[model samples]
Target: MRDLTVAVFRPDDERLEDAVELIDSLGATAVPDPMLAVEPTGSPPRTDADCVVLTSKTGAELVADAGWEPGEATVCAIGPRTADALREVGYDVDTVPEEYTSSGLVATLEGAVDGARVEVARSDHGSPVLLDGLEAAGAYVHETVLYRLVRPAGSGDSTERAAAGTLDAACFTSSLTVEHWLEAADERGNRDEALEGLTEATVGVIGEPTRETAADAGIDVDLVASEATFDALACETVEAAAPTYHE
Candidate 1:
């Protein structure tokens, strides 16, 4: 069998081992080239708000890291996994979108936002779409940067092969993963050739935004999980790409 290389651009250390296990089960080499590295913010905010919006599991973990818990106010999550994470830490999630995205979550809000205060717990580098949309809905948005996502230092030789068109697929969990991969490709001077032939290979994305980012980068997404969790994404990638490998 030809050796298949699949890069998992996972930013979180907590999720890397599981991603590796799943990728290895597919008989493909998994590369740990993290495009985004997360580091926690100093502390959770002290101000009280009417609601808290969590955009990622990373955000929920940060809240736990800060030793804070949601009290009285409603907690809204962008997806089920995020809500589950919050629930693990004792938060009562009031809203979670069927589609795992900020736009979808914002659309599912309970009441008029006028006079309500909402705090968004997320990475400093994350998109401001949710906060802006919430404010536009008349909720006072308190933006808290609970973590920062930075690109990891080295991506190694397999990434070079991936850029050179030898790899079969790549996995993306966040829109930033696609952005950072493209940036890394640019830095390595492989941008043009990489995108042109990217569609020939499979791309696995976690959510709508990541899928859209893959499409914007001219890569065809061949797999997206029914659920937005890391495990679900990895399983979907293997299940979707297994037939091709066997054939």
Candidate 2:
């Protein structure tokens, strides 16, 4: 079996459960860290926009729960998972880019959103790429803060494991996860130690923006997953740490 210990920072929920299961399936031990916690703003997206965009599965679910009705509006999602979430909530997704990142959504919608009112509904820590790209393309872009992601209490166990050099790999799904991981380390008075140990481990991020954030924070990222999916990130990080899975 693959013996690598991979650290993953997802909210302690079904997402973390899925990640741990996926790592186990690949034969790699999972070091699950609950990092992001969703605090909904109770603010729904505007329904009168020409197009409505959802960036995460949580955002899609939140908006759907708010009963956001998209009347004569194009529903855009950044990835298949989010699109699937929207569809599951009885919303018709009109556009999903070939690439799952914000940059990809920008590229896919830039040509068509030149004169449209684009509504981007996501978490507080969302990247500026989508909003900026849409605005640059001449769309009147409005951002709706569906939720704010905060670090959960008692969630830095993986940082201690990282500092101890026990982690063979890490899957960072968002920029906030990377930043909050280091913050947790700092609070434990092992920031430098954790960072040093992290350098020895294979690091995988969800997309280019996360890679940039990690690199800027002095964490050498090993690879950016081909897809912006947790399964892709976990598997890629596992492969980077242990090229061949045993047993």
Candidate 3:
């Protein structure tokens, strides 16, 4: 298949099945092998936090799973996708920045931090920018790890998918996914081959920071979404890959 294949760097768990199917329907193969594990700690100590911050769909999904209602707190999401996820479960998203990242969220947090209590729901590998920024602004910042970024023992189903040669491209949504994919492939003794395939294949990232990480590792990004959202990413991917087959 000359059509682009999108290796979804999400975990092979059942949670992402819908997304995989959706991508596959676009005439692209979807390979799932998560570089991160989302761990829910249930509801943490909810303080008098004036606002709630979400960094990813994982964080928003964790909030949805906790079944807790926000009480007089503003909800700030890093991007439109995270905000949509939060809103899907009846959480009102109060802020979404044009640029998507914890650092971007930190910039927006400065003005809002005055006399406010803020809590961040994010992964164990979350950046310190948001937490540090809020603390510096004199807002009490609370945070809990809702996930862990870890590599698997092997390539998982991705290796089989790769060998099929239907794969044309792969999308790395986060830095952890890129790192963990390499780490996991290394454990399987196919690290070099995998790296070669990834490098030769069309590589797409979700945003600038992730692109920086991939580029630093010598992977050139073929495409990046204009907006940092799943819908945007998927659309951009399909657009980027569509021209190769349409001719």
Candidate 4:
């Protein structure tokens, strides 16, 4: 079995180190070229919501940065990573759905949030599933965009590698990563070639929603982790690319 190179397109945050460690554990070279930068939009408005929902680790960090304390309000996170982020900043999370998607969060809050007040903090580009569902379920939802995702400057190396067909697999944690990666390839005048190259390589995504998003953008996802976390995505990538696993 030849050593594989897995290109990781994510933010250069603590999670990036986790992905690198997981790839190294599988004896593969991890090429981490962060594609997106998370920028806090602004300080969130003062709210008296009964519950606070955080959908991403960046959102948790942003809320903490805004100096908002979840006093008596219930803190609900979308997944373990987000929950950990909130916990690390001194908030005890009250709920984390078995599934990590917005739909899953909505399902968990449906019966519990009737006639309640909820504040949701997430990215500006976040989907409306959770917000809309909560509102429909009788929660007065105060949705705030705490952060925004933008393509980082001078981070096109992984896209170039993909264009050159040098990567064995690429792990995309979000749909934006796929979009930004292809946009970078297009900027280099190699969009078509990069798309072809990606078709030959394994595409690992964090969850079904991201896989659907990638597929909508013409990327055929080869692996999808059962859980929506970097570690799970890295493991799925290894399983798809490891020669011993194939044998």
What are the per-model numbers of colliding residue pairs? Answer: 0, 0, 4, 0
lDDT of each: 0.76, 0.90, 0.72, 0.84
Rank candidates by TM-score, best first: 2, 4, 1, 3
Better of 1 and 4 by lDDT: 4
Model 3 collision count:
4
For model 4, residues 1-247, the per-residue Cα lDDT tens digits are: 4568899977888777877888999888898988889888796834687988988888887778788887788889999989999899878999999998899999998999999999988888777888899999999999888888999887768767777877788899888888888778877888877788788788899877788888988888998888888888888887787753331
Point out where model 2 deviates above 4 Å. Answer: 244-247
> Stretches of candidate 4 above 4 Å error?
244-247
Measured against the true structure, the TM-scores of the candidates, in listed sequence, are 0.84, 0.96, 0.82, 0.93
* lDDT value, candidate 2, whole model: 0.90
- Which pairs clash inside model 1? none
- Global Cα lDDT for candidate 4: 0.84
lDDT of 1 by residue, 1-247 (tens): 7666677887647677777878898777787777888777676854588888888878887788778767777888888878888888777889888767777777777355678988888888666678777888889888888888888776433347665777777788888888888888888887777775566567788888788877877778888777777777877776666668643
Pick out the ten consecutive residues of candidate 1 with the lowest summed lDDT. Answer: 154-163
- Winner on TM-score (1 vs 4): 4
Can you list the residue pairs that collide in candidate 2? none
